[model samples]
Target: MVTHYGRAVLHATRHGFRVERPLQNPQALLRVAVGIVLGTVVGYVLDQQMLCVGAWLAGLGSMIPHQRHRLGVSAASAVLLCVVGPVVGVYVHDVTWLLYVLAFLGVFAGGMLMMFGIGLGMRAIIMTILMVALADLAPDVPTGLTVVKWLALGGALGWICQLLPPHGPRFATQRKAVAALYDALAADVRAAAEGGTAPQPWPGPLLAARQTLTVLPQFSRAAAASLFGLVGEAERIARNVRVLQTAEGAVPEIYRAQAAAVAGALSDVASAVRSGRPNAVTADWSSGALSRTRSGEAHENRVRDLVDALTEAGRLVDVPDAGKAADSWQHTELTLLHSQPGFVARGLRRLREELTWSSPVLQHALRLAVAATIAEAVGRATGDWGGLGEPGHAFWLFLTAAIVLFPTFEHTFSRGISRSTGAIVGGLIGWALTLLPDARALHYLVLIALLFLYLAFRSTGQPLMIMWITAWVSYLGAGGSSAWTRTADTVIGSAIAMALYLLWPTWQSKSLPRLLASWVRVEGQRLGALAAAWADPSTADPIALDRMGHEARAARHKFDEAATHAESEPVHHLARWTGPELRLLSRSVHEVAKCSAMLTAHLPGPRLPGVPDAARYAEPLHLVMSELATAAETGAQPDPGLTSGLRDIFGAELADTLPAWQPGPDVFGRVTHSVEELASAMHGQEAPEHRIRSARREAH
Candidate 1:
């Protein structure tokens, strides 16, 4: 019932856990339980040397949904872990404890050396070694064959857990996350207009939001790995949609107005909540720019129109546009994110505290990059041998770590670090469990119970807790033995990863404000292109626009990376000044989309949407943007009248009224503010257009 953030706060307060995530639906949880039980029994039978694993772990072959079947992947890793685990375990088992320790060091060094290696090989190799050493600790000597059989069964069961169904309370969580951002931006525009009061804060929710970002990439990765095929479409849909920012061409003026309103409203909400004020600006239903006012009559038509354009822009994909009030209601995602700046915010907070690019999403990426390189190294060392007989199938783990992880490098670091931290804690717990005066079966149960506990409730970005729990289970099945070796291996692997990633580093990163400055440059260049285009609408300069798009993409990517690095590297992540800056970026780009639409739209021979030269408003808008960028970079308030003055001048001179055009929510609010803010930014600056006036003066 509680929103994700609320639950996070509750968990943090109650369990000393700040990061929290969704509760699996009863049905989904039940399915996992079923899989585990069946798997345990099957594994039991197989350990007794009974069954054939003519593996289908590749596709839906292992009972995981076809969507999730990495049959090709699992087949390879399972083969290695199963076949190689014992061979390596056998030879190493006979060594003295000192020799064993030496071997561990060799594996550790090998992991880093193979850092540039591919895939899940890293995990396969190291884990294989751990399994082998673990077998040696058993009272009875484990033939390589026994280790292989048990590992195969365990792996098959793990695969089955991943194939479970998605039966959660489907509140469209993913969709909500994205939509909230849209709504928040729209709200900001409206708030800026009408000389609105600042919004009140919402502390409770902010805590939850903070926890979400704190959870790392590993959890998401683990979920996808487990869920496989079913997860692919939904996740890809979100990702591709996000990348559509620069690709958007245009939209209707009314829709633009509405989006502007939402942007303003969201900004207000974010500011208010972060400041801890619950009495945020109340929504004014009548303030919108839709064709009609009533919900039933106008909401559907107007909302649908906006949704359609969003699709055209590649921002929104796969919406039915029924315009349910629930669908359009704001505060779902963006506010949640803004409210709990702690999780996502800490990175930015640190960045800003230290002049790094401090945006939430970007910070996460940086985290991922740092952590992944380490995890990759760890996985590689698991099965590797510097010069021993038959190294572990660690190459599989390496390939998996490299290939499956890190969409954005920064994010991977964030995720990998979170995983390592959690893994250490969980691994310790697993060790503690071994010390209990319990029988072999009891030890296995204790480990499983702890694994389930973590799976059910931990707030996480990294699911290393899950991995540790599994490793502990392996130890137990090996018969209350090998805890010391397993623990050592984990700690060593984590250390290797951290050491390599931290050592003399990529960015030597001193100043992140440069990123903000660079962001302005990128935004400026983009505006300049728009300016040239607006200067003459009839001129088809596709190349400039194309160039602008590429620049925007690169800037966006860099900003994200900068934010990530800023969050992770130094004591304080750099680039704090960048957060509020999103306003200008979002606003300018939205205008660019509008300008593109105005110039490109062919209307039976005319652009009669409003006044005569409304399309020509581009020149002034461009001027406003150039000045705004300068002011934003300098941190001083610009003349607050230029953009507004331009907007008004354009409206009065060019806008003829649209018949029956009821301005959507807060149009007056939006138009009034965007111009005001633009003007404020441009105030006192020598407008780029000033050259035109000067040239005329010389002629006079």
Candidate 2:
């Protein structure tokens, strides 16, 4: 009795149950839990129910990932909620039409704000909608001042909680992030020494470390500058290790032994940095052991460079004065950080870019706005037509639709399913709890426990988190019929979201090519920068190189994420590339990035003789990449001449003039081959293996 449709249904349903690994921050969970409990106690003492809810919402809103900016972010969120809540509440009270208009505008604005970041935008959306629902539910409109006061108190309490101990001192998050980078580098080095594949530098931890440092208070600039110096040292160490890893196979046994030693040293440095005990690092990399077996070969030189970089990193860790003898690298990083636009300016720029109708963010915002408006309208109509007990019954419907709708259809469908299931199950649990004797103390304890569990398990899965949230909300309200009403409303709201997505769906598959093209273009820019650096290191802007590398890495991440979402979509025909082809393109792009990084690691020191032919070859190659990107985006046949030109440039005998520190012909050959493979995958044909092999052989 098994059917194809049944299998498809089962496959899609499984996404609802997918559980990710739980978040590992016990301190953060504890902080959120304490904030919520304290807020509840304050509300009880003040005899103000709205104050309790405001605190709960504020606690959840302040749960941003950037711990260093927690207090500031919490304050900003509180101000936003307090200002927006009362204005919307006053305008929507007892006006059904105004409620719908405000819901649409509020939801749409919140969606647009997502470009700033999810931490702020999602909280704004939820709080704004919740206020709108509260306006509909209240018998009399509360004054704007009263609303502001309650929300401000809750916000203040939440912000104060962020100052709690156990989060470590200022720059703690930055330090931890930098420490993690060292740990990851050590792991990669160990793997490479054991004959594992050459590992790419993970940009995530490095980026996080840099971002945290950027946000440090001006008063902490000295310490932040020192940390920035350390971060640069870590990046250089990573690059040199990557180069060493690439050459490990051909290196002598002495070099491999040195690599093993370096890995151990790196691990110790990580531990030292994490523990703030630089003196504890006992690995003496400066020992004469390396001098005994030095061959002065290219591989030996690379190993030596790696050792030097590691020694510098250790020295940076031990430096006592944070701002003493700041290097050019630290100054450059700090200047860039200071030169960056403020949050408002950056957000406005992003909003302008996303205002286009073709933008996914804009489309999602429109969908959410319309969907929320419809949900509110239907809920209101049903309440009047079916004699639903209260206007607030519609709040669940509006809330579910707002939360469940995502940019992509697959996400919306999956989240809708999870929300519905969690609500139904949680409603049953709440009903069971209601049957017991009423005890305020017991209820408070249970609420606190549920809030903690919800916060702790938030990252585990949407279903589980939503289940706890539903139960907590249900228990917070009058029980029995209210629980059933909320559950039903959730199901209806989920259905409404699903229906709206089905009606006007944005398929990730259709966007895959565009994302892939953007990634390719960014990679090409990085390659061009690398070429320029190799052509003339003295004239090269290290900041520009660093920025391009970051851009390339970020673009690649976005493409990979889009490809994953596209894969889950049922409409495969909408995509220009097949799953296997997309994967091949991804691998090729990664190979290109890795080879560029390898070359970057071996870049000649400033004012050194540079590769003259690099700039010459890069110009045409850039054009070819641009054409390839265009072809990928437009679904048109690429110019065969472009590939031939690249092959010719890569195949030319330029190694004779290349600096010894620059990457060899083998690396260039790999990069060229990756480009060829990427083009082949996009064009739906096999790569020209004979031509590639000939080019690679000629280059060697």
Candidate 3:
């Protein structure tokens, strides 16, 4: 009968229990589990009463798996705070006014420090809050130290457990992503060689490269070097494959066959990466048709160059230490004396700069300080003048305000909604659990499960974190069926946060234009440098070219971030309407960047004598870029003469040598064409309806 009942429930909820989630990171779970168990065991061995306290205190560091150095810092941080918190709490318990003042100042300082960066600000404020809360819980300074030691021991044990894993679960994901990217590259090459269009590598695999870079260092220095090296080789191979596609029609059939062989070589390289073995990539150049191709010598030479580039890329990949850096990868670990670099200096500089009161961070800080202060005060007033007593403890109200308020108004609003909803749901669950038999044991188990889930879902989304945090808090506080008090406090706090933002909103749309302008300007300058170098290699400075590239990429990143923020605004009509324009702008800028990269790659090479350099034509190209930048910034029209002049120069200088140069000569024409389209797009001109229709037809 029991089995039938269970089967019925399982059958009914089968679909409901299904969820789509990314593969879990087992290392994260292991870290948390090890820390909790270690801390609990140590505490229990020392004193049974210390078991829960030890896990609670040490569990903070175990919640997230960071780099080795960061883990150390986190452990030290947990230890220091655990020791200091209880003592501070005791003192604050005696002086209610001091507690209020410290709470205000702690949050205010945290806000001010946050201007430097979120990491710095978050750590400072969170640590301070922990200290104050711990102080209240501790009976005296001596007992606080004991709790601190146990907590530190647990945190330290968790940190030490990180050393046991040879490579983390994230590292495996990184390796797989890199392998997938190479596989995609190989497939594209094979497609192009088979007389088909080479499909672009999907952006998903490319974006995953960034994730690989982030986690590679945490695994091992050797792995980091190998991965980075392989990535560099993969990039070269990809570029060469793209060049082959561009020159497909002109190249002989034999070269296409060779491309197929090269694609196989790339596949081998990818296989080697997956299998943890470095193997030599072999490509057969034995095809006698290479020497007998009817295609002109220029076409033959270009094909040979492509083949050689691919061969060299394969050879480089086979080198075991090609990507290894000599320098140590370990950053400075958290210590009592040597803190994170720029923490003090940058913090002070930012604070000093924001003193004029115009800084958004300062304004936000002021808002947060004011809102949190009021919340704390109200909580104290409601809880027998300090909110320290039972039943009416108002700490949850202050916590709600602290968590809800964010740097941007949109963030605050969104978090306020999600947090309040999650809190209500979680609180109810906690209340329900309290009514069950063996509730005490169940609470401990639930808390442990929540801790694991929180870490696992940290990178996934915010909803789960909100739910778990609310449940965790309620289970610790409310021992009854009614968690209504905390729920009400959360709602009230969220309302206060929303009201403060409404009163003093910081709309991202207001600043997006400036960011866009900056992006355009930097991109224009980068293109100018590339064009100048192509015109005359003598003018090229590798350092300057690299700096411009970095700056341009940074500008684009900033533009994207600002645009994201702007789009999140409640009233962003301007941002919404400019989406298409921004997309066009981004595409044009990327094309320019690609042109620069191609030119940069070809810089130290064969020069044709008697041919005019890009120097004569560079001025008009630069002017076009400058005009585009101006148009992006001030809505000015780009002069058509710039594009026309470059065209005329291209005809006069390179028109006669077109056959000899073949694809290389076409670079100038492509650049000029791109400039024309960019200028037209900037002036609010979409592609002709005929062209759009043609593209759609082709796509279909």
Candidate 4:
């Protein structure tokens, strides 16, 4: 029977939505099952009584499933729903039209405030109204008028369900999520690092994880960015391999084999990336025997293709011996920390997480308080707080309640809108059920079934769970009676809730640009430290490098969040940035990272003393290297002064090159001619048939 409501959860778990936390939670399961048992017993009691009574109370019990130990808040909610709603229904009974008007207002008011854990805010309030109406017209004297008692009982029952002990261990979700990510990542990186692992490895899990990682930039910006970059690079490499593979009939055999090897390596990286279980990754270099055996095959198409891509990557990235670096790789237990350069790079990446309300109690209670306030306001507005129907001494009662329960300060408008709608609808439904005269038992069963079904379907629409509650209450209030009234009550609640939320609003601070700025500021400091350490020779900066991995992972993640938000939002909006602004941000970050990578490559290790040669000057090593970095970071041309300063600091001479790369024969094509003239000057062999410079690089 619990399967009815539990089906959604079952499906979610069955599909294995992986996360860092372990999936097993025995304690949570216990809590849910107990709550179900208790709720069922209470439901059975109500079944023994007026079937409508069981339905009304059961609707209230649903709240318990989420808020296990928050007895006070849940009880308060139940009281508001069961007692106040019914009293209002009774007092206004003779004037059905006036009562209807009041019910509409109440629902509208409830929806405006906030919503419960799940359903649409408006729907919940309207359902409360529906329940009250039913109890009001019942033959039995309305005990629901004793709001205090009913609310307390309902609240306790709900709380019991919420606090049920889980069947699984804690942090299961967190561990699993983290593990799943690393497992994929490890496979990809291992193959690339070791060389020629496999081709056409599956990427389904890795791709999905990539998408998830995108959403978590603030959580792990550097890692996220690096991962995404890896994906992009892998895809590009893989595609190139495929193109070469497809043209094999006409292309040289060596080229085909080379392409295959490159494709295989790229595919490995992609696959390793899938297992993002950081702790599980292991990187091992192929042994001497393996490397020696591969030397002869190096001239083959597969080896050549692989070498080409790897060599190109090293040259572009400015990482020395990158292709050969894989030769010395060793296997170790995979961890995200081990994946990156090390310490200094990985620094302080754990910050910048999305801050949910720190305490679940506070979050839930705040929403409830807002709902209650809206309910009371509308109750008073409709004169539901006055006359015989009104509870005795309304002002004092409200004052006391207000003192005890306060709404959240910042989320006032949004919360108010959601809760207000839910409450008003719930109230009317309860009231109408009092008027129902037939098939009460069947109505209860139907309401229970509908509740589960609604929970299942409500993924996106009114996910706040206002409508589901509203419908439930309508059943309780009207009980196999008028469907039209329930519908009216539900709509009224929605309208009211929307008004409350929109009429007055508070600013949502912690804007994206600020988030972006914070990431840059923190990452810059860490990178600077890493650069300084790496630049110092005779000092092994292993630890510093290790830290860099952390900072890089974090910074990349944060920057992504900033970019996504800044790119999407116009500067006209408060605390927002335009696409150009985001580009500027992106450029700065790219340059900064490049500088750090360069420092990592050149600074940390022993450098053989040698003067800057004429060839080095011709390349303008400092200036050429700094161009992309400067363009990215500042969104401007490289400052000549900065270039001059770097050259002086490094004791390097500038190399001469064309002013710019252009398609015309005079610019890039001229440079290519010069390069071809000095072909041996390039250490890595050039692809004999390649003509990159001749192609004339266009403006990026």
What TM-scores do the predictions have? 0.46, 0.87, 0.72, 0.42
Cand. 4 TM to true fold: 0.42
Per-residue CA lDDT of model 2 for 1-700, tens digit only, reads: 2353244335656887898877557777677677778877877678554565666666666665443556666667666665566556766677877777778888898788775556656876776676766675656655645765776787667667767877554466677887887877777777776756435455656776766665565556666565677677777777877776666335457556767777787778777777676576655686654443445456566566667777777776666766654534454455566346655566678889999999989998999989887887777777733543334577678888998998865678788888889888888877777776677667666777777878877888778888888887777775676677778888999999988987888887898779878878888887877777778878888888877777777777777668777766666666787877777676676667787787787777786788878888777667777888899889898876567666656656555666675546766666677788778777766577735665896796
Q: Write one digit per residue (lDDT tens) for candidate 3, span 25-65.
A: 56556655666666545544564324444454454544433
Top candidate, metric TM-score? 2
Is candidate 1 or 4 superior in TM-score?
1
**Model 4 CA lDDT for position 615:** 25
How much is the lDDT of residue 230 in candidate 2? 68
Which 10 consecutive positions of candidate 2 have the poorest summed lDDT?
1-10
Q: Write the per-residue lDDT of candidate 1 for residues 330-431, one digit (tens) a residue.
A: 322212222233323454454345334443323323433334344434544554344431233332233223322333324334444454455556545655
lDDT of each: 0.38, 0.72, 0.57, 0.37
Question: What TM-score does candidate 2 reach?
Answer: 0.87
Off by over 4 Å in 3: 1-23, 40-74, 80-125, 135-150, 166-242, 248-378, 381-413, 438-443, 452-460, 496-499, 574-577, 597-611, 635-659, 662-666, 687-700
lDDT of 4 at 676: 27
lDDT of 1 at 24: 39
